[model samples]
Target chain A: MKIPKPTIKRLALYYRCLNRYREEGVNFVSSKDIAERLNLKPSQVRKDLSYFGEFGKRGLGYNVVKLVDELARIIGVNKVWNVAIIGAGNLGTALANYPGLLKHKFKVVALFDNDREKVGKKIAGIPVFHVGDLIRLTQELNIEICVIAVPELAAQRVAEIAEEAGVKGIVNFSPVKLRTSIPVEDVDITLSFETLAYNILKANPEMLKLIEEQ
Target chain B: MKIPKPTIKRLALYYRCLNRYREEGVNFVSSKDIAERLNLKPSQVRKDLSYFGEFGKRGLGYNVVKLVDELARIIGVNKVWNVAIIGAGNLGTALANYPGLLKHKFKVVALFDNDREKVGKKIAGIPVFHVGDLIRLTQELNIEICVIAVPELAAQRVAEIAEEAGVKGIVNFSPVKLRTSIPVEDVDITLSFETLAYNILKANPEMLKLIEEQ
Candidate 1:
């Protein structure tokens, strides 16, 4: 199914919050509730979900389980993915240990760091190896996707290697611009942080008073 | 200026990429190139930017500097933000040192962790302090935003405390849901990783078999 890029982004968010909504004993959720959580609009939320099908009723909201299932299927997270993280720094290790990454459909298979001393160490149970072993290990473990958390200077190079190693997808965290016609997605680490800050700043500029009073 | 939420998100990508476009001595970029990097339709890119004043000419494409300036103004990142991070664990410390967040508009002001060993220590010169000191220190430092990189259980509680302490915003990385009537924006950590993976998975399912062969 051809989903708009924006809709695809929202699918991930909907899936992420759906589990929590389930835990809270909330069986149905309106577009407004989801929008508030993500700071998005209810209309957009409804429209995005409506793109798939009518998961909601006339007066009620979407069924949590049903919506999650639909979204999961739509985003193609219905299957498992063995991920290879290409940086072993704090950010890389964080991603390796990030609970969100493993939730239900994702898995970290290996970690690659350039540092000799750090190689062979393990983070969140995933073994870390040298970046030199990326090609070898990816070939051996059948790692289809790579998460590039390396330094900015190394982003393009790591992406090149990952593509050459036959990586199907890449979730890059480097602040550098790396393009791979090989289905690589660069996570704009800094831009998101600023957006996060902007969300709060827009809501309460007076909050800056705390810093000033300090 | 009420812009569609999707437009705001895309604007972030445009601003980041256009900075590079300007640096590369490229003065004009079409909506098509923006669509390529951001993974959106060329028409969608043009339409989003249309809400703002026309930085794009009919035949000539967008002026790199002018577009960047408009985005900067529209996204409200034209000024610098002193950002404070709470919870200096793997995520916090990693975020503190993240090169992307340290760029043009955001600055890491303070780091807060409950761990005694981490307190008084500094990651990238941002001193890690006791979580207990957050309210006091944030007020003094004029921190414009708060980053909640704590564990899932601590996320909502900390956000509450941060709000009471004058924390205007939060960038949550926890797996759990955080309920806040106050101004808050939670980045579902798992959703990001999962969505990026899902998009890639669907984009190149055949590559999965390709990786096995390689």
Candidate 2:
């Protein structure tokens, strides 16, 4: 079954919500409650979940633990994924320290930088290596996922290197648009902020009208 | 006109791509080029741009500078926005140092933390304040945007504080789902990685089939 991209994204969100419910000792939750928590419509929630097998009872909603486990398995996050960060900059260093990634089974096994000084250092206990050694180290460490956190100018090159290293997937934090055979998810922070700005302006139609008038 | 949420997001991406073209001294670019760069269909690109106004000439394509300027104005990035970070943790600190936000007219003017030791400290030259002083400082600094980088447990409370502070928009980096009257864009890194994992597994159907067979 080919799931829509948006549905896959929402499945991850549903998994997170279900985990929270399980942690709170809530055994069962209605689609309405899950929808309300995620700020999504109940029908949308049901449709997204329907892509997989039917897990919810008609009136009982869903079993929190069961739903979470199913989603973890469906999303291929049930096992640990050894990952590598391609930049040792501030963003990369911060992501290395991010507890959420570790909690989600994605481990930053290595960091890569072109600077010789940073190459020997460790961010969050993950040793940084020279970019020249990315292919060798990724293979040695059994790293399947690569994160591109370098600057825009260096992003494409770094992505190419990761591809050459046989990475299966990439999470790109740089603003650059990278084209590779492997699945690449661009995590553009600026785009997220811009979307917020657009929505905020849209909410304030007067502001948008004022800008248009100008 | 009500633009679709996805269109608004692609507009930001289009703006970024246009900027790169302008930097490279490309005066005009066809929808095909833009679509190719963004990995979207040309018709989709045209449809997204059509929401605002006619941008491209029939055969001559779009003027890079004009398109970039129009998108910047349409997205409300033409004017500067004073922003605040509600956490002084590693993620917040890294966001404060992110050059992309500053490039997009969103300025991080204040950082807030509950820890007394970090209250007076500065991350990227932005002074930190006690979370208790958020409302007052946001007002004093004329901050309209807030970024929530606290842990999941504290995210909702921080978002509530930001809402009570009269923030116009929020970019939530915490995994916690927050509900507020203001527009909120949740930057869930875990969800992103999970989505990547799902796509990679989908690309390699054998892996998914093996998981299912287990």
- Runs in model 2 deviating more than 4 A are A21-33, A53-66, A119-121, A202-206, A209-214, B1-74, B110-137, B150-161, B178-181, B209-214
Query: What fraction of the true interface does each of the listed models get right, in terms of native contacts kept?
Result: 0.50, 0.82
Residue B114 lDDT, candidate 1, scale 0-100: 88
As for model 2, its CA RMSD to the true structure in angstroms is 4.4
Q: For candidate 2, what is the lDDT?
A: 0.88
Candidates 1 onward: DockQ, in order: 0.41, 0.54
Off by over 4 Å in 1: A17-67, A204-214, B24-39, B50-67, B205-214
lDDT of 1 by residue, A1-214 (tens): 6878667777877887786798888998888889898778888888888887889987798899888877766676766778898888888877887776666667889999889888877888889889888888888998878888887888899899999888877776776667787765656656566566445545666644543454
lDDT of 2 by residue, B1-214 (tens): 6676667778888998899999999999999999998767888899999989999999999999999999998889888889999888878887988888898899999999999999998899999999999899888998989999887799999899999988999998886668899999977777779989988998898877776676
Give the C-alpha miss distance for residue B129 in model 2, angstroms. 6.2
lDDT of 1 by residue, B21-72 (tens): 9989899999998789767889888888888767788788999998887777
